[model samples]
Target: MPLAEFDSSVGHSFGLEFDSVLIRQITEVSGLKMEQDVIELKQNTADGKYAIKKLPGRPKAGEVTVTRGLTEDNSFEQWIKDSRFGKMVSARRNGSIIVYDYEGMPIKRYKLINAWPKSLEISTLKAGDTSVLTEKLSITYESVEVD
Candidate 1:
C-alpha cells in the first residue's frame, strides 16, 4: 500500500460508533445517553460547565484495560495526555487499551479534582471528535466492578 492509502486509514481522518451496552454504562454514571454515531461532545461547556458531571470514587492505584483497536497508534496517547485526558500512570501498554481505574479496580473512586485525571473514560474519535472524561464512564466503572 502506498503512503497515501495507509495514511488515510491510519494517522488520518476519523469516524465514530458508540455501542449500546457502553452507552447504558455511561448513562448510569452520567445520566446522559450517547449514540454510537456520536462523533463529538463537549467536556467543559462553552459557559464553563462541565459537560459530564463529576462523581465520587475510592482512592487507590487504578487499573485500565481495553481490547486494543487495530488502527490505534501513538497519536491516541498524545491526544489523551493533551486534552481532558491527562497523563496516565505511564506508557500505554502495547496490544491492550488500558482504562485507568483505582485500587486494582477498573474505576478508582476519586473526586474530579482535575477533570481528566478523575475522568473514567478518555476517547478521541476517528475524526477530530473526542469523548472527554466524564461521569458516564464512572458508571461504567461501577458496572464493570459489579460484573
Candidate 2:
C-alpha cells in the first residue's frame, strides 16, 4: 500500500466485544499483553567455560483492564458477581478488543480466551466535580490471540 493510502488506526477508535456482542461506551482499554517466564540454565562447556543459556518457560496468564463511563447497565457487575464464590466456571467468557480504521471498520482484533472478571472499581465521587463517572473492570484470561 502506498504511504498516502495507509491510515493507522487511532487508539481512541476502538471497541470491546463479549461473545460477539459489542460493548458500548468503553472509554479506555489497557494491558492487552502476553508474557512468559524465562528459565536460565548454567552449564560448563567442553572448553571449561561457564555459560548461562536462557530458555522460554511457561506462558503467564494475561490480564486486561477496561474502563467505561458509568451507566445503568448492570451486565458487567453481574459478571463480576458470578465470578465470586466458586462460580468462575459459568462466568468465563470470550471477548475481543477491536481496533477500527477511520471509516469505523474493524482493522485488527485481539481475542481473549476463557476470560473472567477479576475485579471492579468505581471512580471516586465528589460533590461539584465535573469528571465523568466511570467504572474500571479488570479481567484475567488464559491467553490472548491477535487476529
For each candidate in turn, the TM-score is 0.18, 0.91
- Candidate 2 per-residue C-alpha lDDT over 1-147 given as tens digits, one digit per residue, 9 for 90 to 100: 221356555677788899667984789998889899999999999999999999999988989999999999998899899998669777899889898776677778999999999999999999999999999999999998899
The per-residue C-alpha lDDT of model 1 at residue 23 equals: 14
**Prediction RMSDs, each to the true structure:** 20.4, 2.3
- In model 2, the runs with Cα more than 4 Å from the true position are 1-7
Q: Which runs of model 1 end up more than 4 angstroms from their true locations?
A: 1-58, 72-75, 81-147
Model 1: per-residue Cα lDDT over 19-123, one tens digit each: 211211112222212112223444887888778644544443332222223232333344345444434333122121112322222222222112121223444
Strongest candidate by TM-score: 2
Model 2 scores what on Cα lDDT? Answer: 0.88
Clashing pairs in 2: none
Give the Å error, residue 53, model 1: 38
Error of 1 at 75 (Å): 6.8
| Cα-lDDT of candidate 1 | 0.28
